[model samples]
Target: MSTYKAPLADIRFALYDVLGAEALFARLGFADASRDIVDAVLDEGARFNETVLAPLNRIGDEVGCVYDKTSGDVTTPPGFKQAYAQYVDGGWAGLTSPIEFGGQGMPHAAGVPLKEMIDAANLAWGNFPLLSHGATEALLHHGEAWQQEVFLKALVDGRWTGTMCLTEPHCGTDLGLLKTRATPNADGSHAVNGTKIFITAGEHDFTDNIVHLVLARLPDAPAGSKGISLFIVPKFKVGKDGVVGERNGVRCGAIEHKMGIHGSATCVINFDDAQGWLIGEPNKGLAAMFTMMNTARLAVGLQGLGLADRAYQNALRYARERLQGRSLSGPKQPDKPADPIIVHPDVRRMLLTQKALTEGGRLLGYHAATLVDVVGHGADEQERQQADALLGFVTPIVKACLTEWGVECTYHALQCFGGHGYIAEHGMEQLARDARITTLYEGTTGIQALDLMGRKVMQLQGAGLRVFLGMIEAFCKEQEGNEALHEFVAPLRAKAGEWQQLTISIGQRAVANADEVGAAAYDYLFYSGYVALAYWWARSVAAAETSSQSDAFKAAKRETARFYFARILPRTQAHAAAIGSGAASLMSMDVTHFGG
Candidate 1:
């Protein structure tokens, strides 16, 4: 089995070269995010993940999280709590949060790359802090001053962890169907009563408190989603100063048994009239919750990138080490009994696919984080609004595309391992199993696609698309006359134009038939994602051509760029055809005629 190693160099390339994070950070009002600080953080983060977190991955899967029925306490896998303690002591928890709340006050973009490393090391372990980051966002945005002072600091200080309590037994994607209730009390708090399911890190022994941002309905409110309100419901009651008091009415009814990420405690949380405070204004909870949901969607995208990077690294190592047969060219490894599998063309295809997706996905994911930084901390109102529009537009596409691509890349990586990957103990199968949940949780691929095509594209009138297209156009223009970038420039320019035209076409068709949105949604998302990656890959190749790096690194990048353009970018053609097919074929099928 190959041990996981943090891909620090690739991460640096994404941050410094392709993203130009230092220059971007300085321009975006983040003077503290110097290159020296970023690199030091990355180095130490990689070390902690490699030495402390990576080794606990299999341990997490094997032991899983233990549930104590007698006390309703969920204990994480062995060494998990200790590792978290180490994480907190190192001040890693507040890397990019606000300074007043105990954070380092760096640009969120710089923290995002480091987050990718943590997820790659141990996704289950990473889950504990991931939700906390999101909760911090939600609370910081919508919570009152006192709430922020009390809850946000605890979260940022790692004294507490957070969970987005959105789902219920009957409702996964439909928030309108949620039946959780919050009754007003005389003390300006509400009594929350409901059961939230599939809550990650919902009930864990890692911390003294679990802050739940729950969605429920009030008696006097309107019907459906509009009536729902957000609440701050803790596992334990707290005083005004955030001191832990008595246990609240919340309990972990059970921990779910799952196919992957066994270490993550997916719990059924029962809130029996738990004392809670309204997060934002009543009936505006969904709007407020999005502050965290958007944070999570982007974070989940990095999960895909992280999984792909780790799988590729191990697969590449195995491909070079495992000797199988002679190369088609013959005798390249005459000293060995047989040539390594890396000499085979098919093997190269798999490796190249993994490399292309992993690297391209990083550029996309990190860029989104930078947009988030701009949205949150940009110097002026106009800049923040523009960044917000672009960020909103790409969140769904990034969430859906990266995860769908992640599963595909992990499969290819495991396929490179042959039959050995399917069995346990080799650790290849573990990564595949772990990656399966990225698309399911947060939001499924279908939901993300619909959000992209419906909410982001149609409703917003392509506001986000216009910003994104402008970026592609700007980059394409810069490379137009450069001899070294001619191949990339023409194709990228064409794809951007084709994508804009496709969006307009889809919108027109959807006007006549609403089903056209659903029919074309998935295809449109993938189509958008592929073209987006093409832009980033082109930009990356341009960076490599001019960088002061070694010849071998530059050549590898150029070769990978060729592979992506020739093999991967062609995927957009099929998506475009499918999008053009309209909704007729899908609508033609009768519901009553379908077999059970």
Candidate 2:
């Protein structure tokens, strides 16, 4: 089975030294998130996830979630409910929620590492509250005052869970194609009738109720996405006093039989005239649902990071212990039947690839997390808006790049385990299966790519891109004189310039032929992602050099940074070439030519 050890030191390095989140939290007026408090939170979170959640991962996968069709009830894998009870008792659910509710009111950055720990240990279990956090984001931002009082606290207090009900049988990524319907009632509420598929945590025995932030259309609504509206549909009825009451009309019709994350209850939910209230203005549900969708997008990004790091831990352990062919240089373990696998250069390559990708991905996620905190609680409107722009620019890159890397890194991890990885006993294959879904869900890489290139870059006129570019430019200038960082800094400087030029070139090509955008969208996203990570890796090396870190630790960071720069960063070259190829190659292919 897989084993997980929280990479606390690297996480701290990314948060404090590399990203400067300490100063960021202080500047944002996060008075409760002092250095001591943050450290304590990280340590405590690591202990819980590594000890309690990690052990249940394989069990959850084996037993999975059980559903009762007769009663429309779902039972989580054994030990899940108890673990969730412990999680609630420990006040973990509201780690980053507002103080007005029953929460710690910590800054979002402080909670990110804690989340990483949970997700790395057990993704299926971690998803339970992830959807809740997204729901709380929607309600806190767009819900009515009475609705906040009635439902938000329950989510914050971990008394109930939540789900983002967006996908229907007919549509997934395209919100305009959704067929869910909402009818006006005599009272203030609406009767929501829809079947939302692929609903994570839609129904579970872990909590008394589940709050579904569902999207449906009203009778008078316009066609397509503009006509959609969001509603707060709870699994159980709640009173004005925030008391749980009778069951609502919503029910889980069935759970999916999927390739992975069996521990998570991915359900087919049927809403039969469920009583729900409008979350935001009519015909503006997509906008309100975005309040939740954006949060979910980032959360899924972290999920990918968590799984990659966990897979690395298990694979690295196996490499050091499992005997194999002699190293090219010499047999390091002379006394053993064969040298350890880690002695081989090929084995080391795979291990280093995992390390480089995992650490870099963590930094990417951490930077985005800090920006989320900034956008929410920065001292001034200007700072918040700028942060929001930068966050929007990087969110797609973070979501797509990290999840894709998760798939790649997990494959490397499993490959290192050889024949044993193919077996279920070692648990390496489960990581592969779990990693597979991260790319496909939340938003597919293709969808994120289009959003990045089409909506944010071209449509917004590179507003977010300019903000991110400015930050990179400033960082590159700062490291100019430092002889030690010159190796890392020089390449980043060139990459930054190229990144901006690439955007301009794409914009020009797109103006002549809109198909240019779609043709280059995926490649452009990857190019942007690699360049973004290159900047982070450069920052990590600079930070490691200045810190009082141990020689071994500093050496590892420097070596990994070098490997990333030399090996991984060049991937941008191929992506750039693809982007430069224009739309002709893609657009010329006729629909009939797609298959024989």
Candidate 3:
């Protein structure tokens, strides 16, 4: 069986040493987020997830969720409820929420490490509360005062869980095709009639009332996505007095039999004239929903990072123990029948790839999380705006790359196990299965790539890219004199220059032919990601050199940085070449002849 232990040391190293998150929290007026307090939180979170949630991972996958056909109820896997209760009791649900709404008011970055621990410990189980973060963001940003009083407190305090109900049977990516309708009622509320599919935590026994942030079209609203409106539709209706009342006109029609994350209940939620209140202005629902979606996109990125770390952990453990062919040099362990598989060069390659990606991804995800704090509570308006731009730009990269890499790392880890990885006993296959969903959900890699290229870079005039490139230039200049970082600095500087030029080239081509954007988008996103990670890996080495980390730990950082630069950073070349190839090859084939 596989086991998981939170990489607390590395997590702290990333947060405090690499990102300097503690100082950022201090500057942002997060009084309760001092290093001491954050440390305590991390330690406790590690204990809770490692002990309570980690043990239930296999069981969660094995048993999955149970649905009652007659009652339209869903029961999560065993120990899930108990674990969630502990989680709520420990005040984890509101760790990063506003204090005014019964939360701890910690910086969003402070919560990321704990979130990573939860995901790594048990991903399916972690899905239960995952949507709540997005829901909380939607209500906080768009919901009215009354709505906040009635719904936000429950969600913040963990008395109830929340979900984002957007996708329907007819619509997954395109929200404009939605058929859900909402009609204003006599009591100042609306009657929401819709069927939303693939709603995570849509129906579960963890909470008595499930708050769903539903997207539906108001009557007389314009057509397409503009007609949409965000609504607060709870499973159990709540009154002004904050009392949970009778059941609303919502039920779980069914749950999906997914490829993985079986412990999570993905429900087909049907709302039959459910009493609902509008979250924001009518026909402005997509903007409000995006408030949730953006938050979710970041969280989903962490999910990928977490799963990859877990897979790497288990694979590393297995490789150290599993004896295989002798080392190429000779039998170092002559007493044994053969040396461990880890002695093989191929195995080391796979393990290092996982390490490089996960550790580098931690910085990428954590820095984005820090931007959440900065955008919300920056020292000045310009600071907040820049952070917002950079965050918007990085969100897609984090979501797509980390997730795609999650699938990659899991595959590598499973490969390390050889045939044993295929079997269920080693628990490697489950990780592989769970990692698959992160890429497909939230947004697929293709969608993210398009968003990064067409929307962020093209539409926004590369505001975020400008900010990121500036940082790279400054870092490169600062490190130019340091001989230790000379190798990484020059290459990173060159890549940064190339990245900027690549963006310009794509934009120039896109001006003439729109298809150029689509053709170059996927490759462009990945190229950006590889270069972005290269910067982080180099900074990681610089950070380690100055920190008080043990000599061995510091050496590991240098070696990993070396490996990443030499072996992994070269991936940018292929992506850049693909982008240079342009839209001709992609658009040349006739559509009708493609099926053959």
Candidate 4:
């Protein structure tokens, strides 16, 4: 099986050197989140993930999760429960949760490295606690004080895991069609009744009680999305004092037997008049749920980044060791019968593709995390609002691009192994399979595209886009005199202008035809993503040139930045051209003529 290791050096460089995360954290009132403390956290997170979780990845995939249909219980693969225990013991669960609720209260950015480590080590196991962040966000933002005391503490301290119950069998993206009902009781609680599908960690052996942030409808509520309400339901009932009580009406009907992340239970949860408490105001569940969804969307982006990094790491190792045909330039390893695959230009292309995407994606994902911190704790209200808008703009790009690139990177990684990658023993296939789901879940790439083009850019009038373009322009101006950065800075500045023009053009066409948004959305998301990476890549090169990093490290950053600009950045051209084509061709085709 291929081994896994956290890319600590690259992670550190991105967080501290490239992003200047420490200074930002200090300025945002995260005084306790000093470089030393955050560094130590990274070290321990790496050790725990690499030693405890990495070894379990193969076993988890192999054994998968076991479900007792009769009892409605799910038993996670062996070693998962133990690793989670270690995680809780180490205080990793509440690393970024509020201090008042039994948490360490670190900056959100500080948790990004730890999250990346967990995902790279074991994504399936990571899914078990993944929704906890969203659950915490939902409760912290919308739940009642008593609900926080009862449910939030357990989830924060890792005494219990959490799940976001959004998708139902009848409705996936359209929550308005959901049939889940929440009937009011005289005791001020609600009885939730309905079935939720694809509920990650819906039922697990790691914790006794699973806190479910469910979406349902009130009896007298209006129709459609606006009428939905959010509720807190648990596997086992609890009281105001926080003591676990009798089992609730909720039960795991079944677990999905499918493509990947087999160790993570994707359960069909049934709430048969389950005891629940209302969260936020009536008919405002969708808005409240966005609090959780926004968190999950960013975390899903990190999942893609982590898996891509893992795939790249293994592919690089294989290219160096797996001897193949001699290079056209002549055998570099004359002592061996044939040269290693790394000597071949085609192999280099694939490797470099993986490297460029993985590294550039790291900066993109981490920068979003930093924005989360700024949105939450910026000193000035205007600064916080601007950060929030920027975060909204990039969230879709980060989610869609990282995931689509995750699938792309893993495919290239497997191809690097030739026939060997297809086999289970090498573990490349599992990574590929696992990467597929990231794009599908947490809102599909298509959903994110519409969100970006239809809502963020057009409806919100490009508030987030303007902020991002300003950053790129300001960066280019700041580094104009630095000749070493001219190669990347010049093109990046031009791309920023093109990005603005592209947005304006799309807005103009959208005024005449509404279908223009859908047609331009997918291409526009990728276009935005590639240009965003261009800015980050430029910044990465500039940061590496002056940092105290090793000579080899510095050179690698510079060369990779060059490779990205030369090969990957041009992908934006294709996307832009496609966007320029307008929506006529797409909408002109009649439904009856689709087969033709």
Candidate 5:
């Protein structure tokens, strides 16, 4: 079975050495959380994921979740319940949750790396707790007093799990056409009646109770998204004493048979007059849900990074162990039957590409996490606001770019294993399949592009763009003295400048012509994603250069940075050119032009 060892040293280097996460943590009033505490948490997280959760990945995928229609009960794969119990016992579920609700209240920076470790170990098992964390975030942000007291504690403590109920059969992205309805009862509660499809962790036996943060429309509400309201609909009703009471009106109608992540129970939830309490204000559910949606989007990006890391590790190990053809120049190991695959230039290329992207993604992911912490707990309001604006602008890029790169990285990793990759035993196929969804869900790549070009960039009038460019410029200025980093830094700055010009041009055309935005949106998003990754890689290279001369780690960092610039970063050129080419060619062709 494939197992994961958390990249502790790399994480420390990124957090303390590169990003200055420790200083930021202290400044943000997280003074109690020192380096020792962080190390202990990470160590515990690594052990738990490797020993308890990682081993069950394949088992869960094989057995999956079974639902008995007559009994209305869901049984998880073997050992899942025990593993979940262990997860709760270790307090892994509340690593970043608020202390007021029985949580540890650790900073987001601390939580994110731990999340990556678990996700890399087992994407399927990792999902069960992930959804719950998202739900807790939503509830804490939008849930009312009574609702928080009842549901938040259970969720934070991992005694209960949660799922977001969106994406109906007829409507997925277009929530304006959704048919779910919530009717107000004589009591203070509302009766929710709707069918929510593609609900991850919708039905499971991992926890005693399941809390659903659902989106539905009130009976007398206005039409479209404006009418939508958020609700806390639980599987089992909670009594005043904080115990599970009667079975609620919610139940799993059916479970989705998916291509990957089979261990996660994706359900068609039937809410037949399920008693629920209102969260936030009526007709503002969409806005409220965006809070959870945005967090989920970032988490989804980490999912991509995690899978790519695992794929790279597995492939790297295989390359070192599986002897293949002799060296093209000459045999280095003359006594052996064949040289290790890692000795080949092409194999090295593939592994280096994976290393560059995955490592770069880890740094970027941690940066985003720290941004969230700064936004929430920064020393000053101005700093908080800046962090908020920057994070809001980059969330789409982080989600779309990282996941897209993740799938590409996984593909290369699988190819490294050759025929063994196609087989189930190797687990490469599963990693690829699991990664495929990250780009599709939490808003598709096209949707993210539209959000970036249409909403974030064009709408902000370069405010957010200016912030990003300013940061890049400052970094370049700081590294100007470093000879080794100059090569990577200069190209990154040029790419950023080119992308900025392209973005402005696209915005200009999009304003005059609505159709142009649609045509240029996808390419523009890809360009932005590429440029953002390049910036991250450049900074990583600079940090890696500062390490002690005797340490070979700096060499690894430089090699990965070189790989990124030579192989991966060049793709942005094509994406930018496509964005600048306008929307006519793609939209001009008729439906019957080439197809029957």
Candidate 6:
């Protein structure tokens, strides 16, 4: 059996049962997005992912991507262009784009789950289109009127693709040291020059043109990140009549040999005075670029969750079918040559861990996606602001925690397959390798932790934290008598309380000691992530209790929740202790200490 299925029931449960996605859609006046429409969309998305995309998984990994310097073009694995053509023909590329831009205008919540399914089926293939979505988001928010009119339609229709060019050899996380430059031309345009490395989908054959949203410093601008500006640099320049024009100065210097996601092209692009148009106001490029980064970060978290889900599905299938030693209680399958591995307690433990985390991650991702919709279309300004603030707080947590656990979950899933897990045939190893990049790209886990603690929490004066805690507290109050769910909620509340106190303590300490914040940041972010997942699980359990208690559905929910609290939730204690210990230990370690 393949590791790809619709997971339709679970998706429905999360969307309608737990997250109230249906009501939110109706309340937001998205009248066309009814339950039937949503289900149909999901079903079609699943079918495409399972059938059209899943076949490319192994082939893409094996063939990877090839760059021909002489031709200045990157070739995708066999059948990728055909698959992408089908994807575009079906209008999947514009599923959530604005209606004015020739898109379906569906809510992000609807589109994101579809994205997860595709990513789970084949992460490497999914990344190209995923990056395009990020670029589209940046353009929609920050692009000028003419720029939007000229580019948004083609982008939304998938006639063109997009990429974000920010990272350089000297600057990855530290954009302040970025050396790319944009010099003003006689006309309103600018001449972009410099090289950008680690650019995903930087150059590809998937579309007619590639729109690059590049970050560069203008001449006579101030030093550091403050002087940077965003520009639209198309691979093939667009003329006044919207026709493809001459090739711009940009060229792919080389492609990197990476650990994973080899199917997605990561190129070193050299921009030698390329014609470019500035995006947004001068010196506000960071803000515009962040529009893409924040979206990409969440998408990366979804990538992590998708990989975990796929790994778990594959592992579960293997466990149930692979015969091994007899059951602990004696031969229930005595008639057979051997019992299946699923009969063993340890195998069950690993499977349960994967299920709990993947399901929990899905719930969290869908919840966050709903918040994006709320922030975009909510009735009240305060509601939108609150959603924005809370989302900002959880963004780093979602990215860091999900990606980290995704790698762990995939590893455990591989372990379930024994020797076969390591083999490329089963595709388990590929899942783990592909998952590794989710943590590294978007932002490393350490960078995410710093963003959470230093920017989201400390700089915002804990406004986001208070909003999140208040919501959790209100939920606890509402469900005080919910015995079915209180078992999950009570522990969650206590853990969340500990987390809040820990945050307060750390925040206080960091004021007097900058090192203290850095030291505790990662641990604090992780602890908070656990707390967040626990809250999601609790809500899921409560929703399950209120639903018609079909034995299979209710039993799975309860079992998954039990597995989470018993095995997964306990790790937060370690994170809390580590955070409480402060930065002194980390700072005091001498260089010689590592030599031993």
Q: Between the candidate structures 1 and 6, which one is better when assessed by lDDT?
A: 1
RMSD to the true structure for each prediction, in A, is 1.0, 1.2, 0.8, 0.9, 1.4, 1.3
lDDT of 5 at 77: 88
Which whole-number lDDT from 0 to 100 does residue 533 have in model 4? 93
Residue 122, model 6: lDDT of: 86
Better of 4 and 5 by TM-score: 4
> Cα lDDT of model 6 overall?
0.89
- Model 5 lDDT, full chain set: 0.85
lDDT of 4 by residue, 310-379 (tens): 9999999999999999999887999999999999999999999999999999999999999999988888
Give me the overall lDDT of model 3: 0.94
- Model 6 misplaced stretches (Cα beyond 4 Å): none
Clashes of each: 0, 0, 0, 0, 0, 0
Assess the local accuracy of residue 377 in candidate 2 as a C-alpha lDDT between 0 and 100.
79
lDDT by residue (tens digit), candidate 1, 305-375: 89888999989999999999899887679999998899999999999999999999999998999998888
Question: Tens-digit lDDT track for model 6 on 356-394?
Answer: 888888988888888899999999999999999999998
Clashing pairs in 6: none
* Cα lDDT listed for each candidate: 0.90, 0.90, 0.94, 0.93, 0.85, 0.89
TM-score of each: 0.99, 0.98, 0.99, 0.99, 0.97, 0.98
List residue ranges in candidate 2 displaced over 4 A: 241-243
Work out candidate 1's RMSD over C-alphas. 1.0
lDDT minimum window of 10 residues, candidate 6: 1-10
